[model samples]
Target: MQSDKPSFVFTGWHMLAAMLLFFGTIITVNFTMAYLATSTWSGLVVKNTYIASQEFNGKAAGIRAMLSTGIKGTLAVKDDSIRYGLAMPGDKPVLADKVTAHFKRPVGEHQDFVTELEPAGAGVYEASRQVLPGNWIVEIIAVKDGETIMHEANRIAVTGEGK
Candidate 1:
């Protein structure tokens, strides 16, 4: 007499089911990662890539000319403002005709901001605005005689430790 228990057998149907489950899992994981990555991603900075590429050399030349001038500067982030301190070849502090600060987030463009830093004093420019505490790429520009006399960029972290 044979027992009523059915013998379990590996067959084509089992193989097909396993393959579907494996492929389905991979597809689901790939989609999930793609979704999470785009939330804070930022694309190209240049509006027109072709134009930017064509004018890249000219822009570099202008920046080089600006750096040739013996000027130095420092930027500090404050609770209510960003301070820019500049100096010429001499130890004396000097203020350019126009000064601006461009702040951009490392990961995304949503929090990026650009504003002219007002004259605080001799060789000092300040922009009064609260900045979110995190990573930032700062570009400081000083314009003199209708030309950019200096351009400087630096990466910094703003921790709300003191605040």
Candidate 2:
């Protein structure tokens, strides 16, 4: 008994189409990811690697010395105001002649700014500046009698609602 309907067959063209679709999807995804990565971040940590390497040990030693003092810092961002405070091991206020903060974006320097904080109280410093909500790398420096007492870097996320 011969039926009128004919069975379908998978031919070379079908195989070629399958391979093309598979490879095309993969290539498209790769190109999109590469473009996004290059466009977002410049991937630059330092201008000169050799100079940074040479100073690494000295910076490490300075950080160790700074930590030995058992000084702690606090940062508060509210609306357009930035506040910083320093305390000793026993929670005593650390008085400093000058306090400055360097705020930088993690991926770019376009939004970076340095502001000197005014003394609000014993160990409290405050600055009125508008910082956009995003990730920030803050470097706080406190100097007393022209000598650095505290030098610390901290990473913080600023949300839409300042707190």
Candidate 3:
């Protein structure tokens, strides 16, 4: 005669198995997310933080001075080009003899570019570029006497298709 009965009691092996599965899933997910974040990150906001910090005060003062002088600018996107316009208080639209446009993508540095604008009219400048539709940080630098006389930086919304 043999006794046949199913055991329904909890055991150490069962507890160990459940714990292993629970912790394994958590560890796997954490590692995967960490890998993806590091791989996509560009790192470093500035090459030398100390130098940038040193120049920060002067830059702020210069911007304030330029603002009071009634220097104004606008940026627009056209067909594979960016139309820039400058408004100065004097006779000419551009206050400086040389004007350059600098574009930077906030998310990454690889998309950063610079182009010198050709005078389209008295106050208008035209520069052609293949710009992707997103947030763009623009700086219009006006140079005179071999130095940057005035600069304006603003964020612009770019629409339309991107390549």
Best by lDDT: 2
Q: Give the per-residue lDDT digits (tens) of candidate 3, residues 108-139.
A: 77778899887888777887778888898988
Better of 1 and 3 by lDDT: 1
CA displacement after TM-score superposition, residue 50 of candidate 1 (Å): 1.1
List the global CA lDDT of all models: 0.86, 0.93, 0.80
lDDT of 2 by residue, 63-136 (tens): 89989999999999889999999999788999999999999999867789999999999799999998899899
Query: Which 10-residue window in model 1 sums to the lowest lDDT?
Result: 36-45
2 or 3, greater by TM-score? 2
| Local error of candidate 2 at residue 96 (angstroms) | 2.8
In what order do the candidates fall by lDDT, top score first?
Answer: 2, 1, 3
The weakest ten consecutive residues by lDDT in model 3 span: 88-97
> How much is 11 displaced in model 1, in angstroms?
1.6
Flag regions of model 3 displaced more than 4 Å.
1-7, 89-92
Question: Model 2: what TM-score?
Answer: 0.82
lDDT of 3 at 87: 78
Per-residue alpha-carbon lDDT of model 1 for 1-61, expressed as tens digits? 9999999999999999999999999999999988878765846688899999999999999
Error of 3 at 117 (Å): 1.2
